[model samples]
Target chain A: MTTAIARTIDAIWKMEAARIIGGLARRVRDVGLAEDLAQDALIAALEQWPAKGIPPNPGAWLAMTARNKAIDRLRRDANLRRKLDELGHELEDSAMPAEIAEGIQDDVLRLIFTACHPLLPHEAQIALTLRIVCGLTTEEIARAQLVPEPTVQQRIVRAKKKLADAGIGFNDIAPEDFDARLGAVLQVIYLIYNEGYSASSGSSYLRLSLCEEALRLARMLVHMAKEEAEIHALLALMELQSSRARARTDATGTPIPLPEQNRNHWDRLQIARGLKSLETSRNLGGPPGVYYLQAAIAACHARAVTPDATDWPQISALYSLLFELTQSPVVRLNHAVAVGMAYGPSSGLQLLAPLQTEAALRDYHPLWAARGELLYRAERHAEARAAFETAAGMTRNAPEKTALLARAAACGQ
Target chain B: MKVIVFVKATADSEAAVPPTAELLTAMGNYNEELVKAGIMLGGEGLKPSSFAKRVHFDGPNRTVIDGPFTETKELVAGFWIWEVRNMEEAVEWVKRCPNPMFTASDIDIRPMYGMEDYKEWDKEGGWLEQEVKLREQIEAKNA
Candidate 1:
């Protein structure tokens, strides 16, 4: 019975953390405090849910409990009369229809924007997004961020104070503001997904948990913002990329390039979901955001029955569009590769030449690795070897480092 | 050209944070705006400070600062790189941003070192070659 209760609590936590936090944030107008109150609610559930059995509406129970905790905290503070008065207006006379308070709301969206607010540091935003928005533990977030756990912890603490000081509120974004809000959320989710896809600091080739969390958040966003084509597009992009998780690495955990990955090992379910989401985005009849465009590009690959059948021209065009939209160095780099595949190595090299000035790419390992491969395909073996060697030196990941060295050796062969 | 957009975190270090609906929605909206405006390079929230540690050296002795840090306000949460026209433009864009914290928070902007400052080093072929090579690798890998 206890085991069953524990399992139920786990599920509830996963499904309700965002909602609980969101509701509390609205009440307190303090994300940090809201989270604290939510945790207190979670703790109460942990302690009593087993004995009480699963409540008919677990989310509502949690919200009510958290609300009570917030009230308690306010009462204890003594000088929080203004806060209490506001709460009185917000929560007063409303029926405690446990279902209504616990239902899926826009709080998660609000939380994402708050966590990604301009006042916090980038690292802090990532950490806070994972923790408060995605329900990840600090240790888990630290592992995902590839920073020392303490560093992630400090950033989160500092982030909360920053949020508090900024006085940002938890509210629905106006229709005019929705696009920008969604973009920020997508950026954070994409960052999380990328960190999992190509971890910056960990020894492992992938942290599946981070990827899963990102996908989950993307899915939630899709559900909450059904009218937003880009939201579905973002989810589609993540799902398509994530479908290759099994084939992205070997048994020994070495990285596997897309061309080498066994299509049979790809998760067909995820692919189908991705394709469906892509279709949904397209059907919405609006200019798709960069993620949507990229998802369309990803769909081109997903739809291809074989690697050789890939529509490189279309991908190249799509990437070109992305570059026009964002002009991001990263997108330009990707465009160079797509152009190379669609056109020729010479053309690709020309595209890549200008990106040489991007300072952030200086120590970035993939840049050299990609250059080496392009050089290899162009039959510049010596240069390719040098490029790969350089990449190996820049990267700290053992497997990636080994892969670069092996690629360098192959250039000689 | 050297605009730095501050992105502070919103979780307390010493205290464990659980999610609330309001927080989630705000974060989502804010991130969307940042992306739509193309001001976002990269951003994320951090874990709390207790799990944080800093390595420092005082002369011959090396010191590590373990969290929870004493001052929350003094700590930086997160940041972004924006290639705006100038600091003023960056500030204007920032001025429109919603407050990060539920109470009150500030975002700091700092310019990065530019080519002119690194001219002497560039002449020495410092990291340019490496950068190009890395870019190539990433392209090939992604391709």
Candidate 2:
């Protein structure tokens, strides 16, 4: 009714909707149905809440409302008989055990798995995740992924139908299947966070919302599978990076280098949360997953009081572990930058020498960006300027281009 | 007031229609806000004009316009329906809503007529009642 009321309701919904829908999907075993029921509940709220006043526990209220709507739909739909037979007679939402919340998380995780399912193209998986699980509309998903909106819509529709047709149960898969699904989940989360950290396109460099969603999803995974050290590590890594969000950009949305950023603006709470999660990974006591290693590296950054105080050696060591685990050219490129800081630019440049020929990374803007940094550090200003120029040319984001161009100018100066 | 918010999509404004991971994240947050507010009533973006076409008729003639239309600004994107108290309320909400693009964008809102607007039509009803009933049935099926 009023601006304040609308804003308050909006804030609560953003925080709670994912978990509520996740929980509902687990019960219904149908992503589309779960979303529909959730929306129905939202509609009921829109009609009722302004007059009744906000509920004391809005999340529980929404969940309860969604459950009721699901039951009502089950009763009223023409296919009720067959649907009940398939879902079992005890499919009422209110009767759902507390364990179903856990089930919902599993569904959310399963939805992630489905979106990231290897059967579909990478673009399709991304588009589907943003659409189904993230509750983003198809157009928004398309805009985020930089594909045409129809392309995104088709991918999502196909993704959902594929999941339904494949008879992919929302609950447990085989160990191998679980691993495959988890890999997809990790990739989707990483993609979302990476996009937020440094936008692939657009005028602004940082997108706090996408980063926050990814971080939240990652954390949900951690809670869903606590013993998985890699999950904890990934969560920690995301949290640590997110801690730097406020310091990532200037007032005009230009990229701000870590060293130049006002560290005070970094979220101390997020840094603390990240470190705690990292501790959880360490306590699990196995070789860290790729995400864990990266989190460890981020933790080093978080712990540092100043740029000079950063633990380059430790970060370099973590990157070494990550390189061994993932073998991604991008990982190696990052390791090279860390090595430049840990030892000397010569060693880093030597490592980069071989990578320059790596086909996978030939067009990667960050590879050239790292090379430029190494050369600049080595005082090969002219070569560094060329590298930065190349990086600036390759990048699509305005802020990243600005950063690279500024670096290139400094190289000649 | 039952307002039909028309969401028109166009790809002509930019060379690339694909959103970066970062922009998706921001847009995701914005959508979450909309959904939470209870203003969102069925919204989605369509594919580019390349996969789309329009059919029209003049007297008994038929015409088709393939997508990638020269005038994208005039194109109709996807839209949402909001049941607010009045048009002024809808305008206030739209004014505060985030611009979907970093460049610039606009949304068009049109009010939908309900049963109350049908008094004169009802008085002259012949096949209109049957048409209205059929429409209701279709809406129920879709819902």
Q: Provide the overall lDDT of each model, using Cα atoms, as 2-decimal numbers.
A: 0.73, 0.70
- Candidate 1 segments exceeding 4 Å error: A1-7, A50-56, A76-78, A84-105, A143-153, A172-176, A199-206, A356-360, A363-365, A380-398, A409-413, B1-143
Q: Give lDDT tens digits, candidate 1, residues A320-348.
A: 88988997788888888888888988888
Tens-digit lDDT string for candidate 2 (A1-413): 57766655655554455667768777767766776788787777777788898786777888899999888887788674475367554344324345543533455566666567766666667766766556665665555555688887787777777766765545534454555667777887888878766762223222434665576567556656767777778878888987886566543445677877767768786798799989999999986777888889889989998899999989888888888988888888888888988899999999888998999987788889889988988889999999999999998978789889998999876
Clashes of each: 113, 15
Tell me the deviation in Å of residue A315 in model 1.
1.5
- Report per-candidate DockQ: 0.01, 0.01
Q: TM-score of chain B only, all predictions?
A: 0.66, 0.69
Tell the DockQ for candidate 2: 0.01
Candidate 2 iRMSD, 1 decimal: 19.9
CA lDDT, candidate 2, residue B54: 81
User: What does the lDDT come to for candidate 1?
Assistant: 0.73
Show the lowest summed lDDT stretch of 10 residues, model 1 chain A.
A199-208
Candidate with maximal TM-score: 1
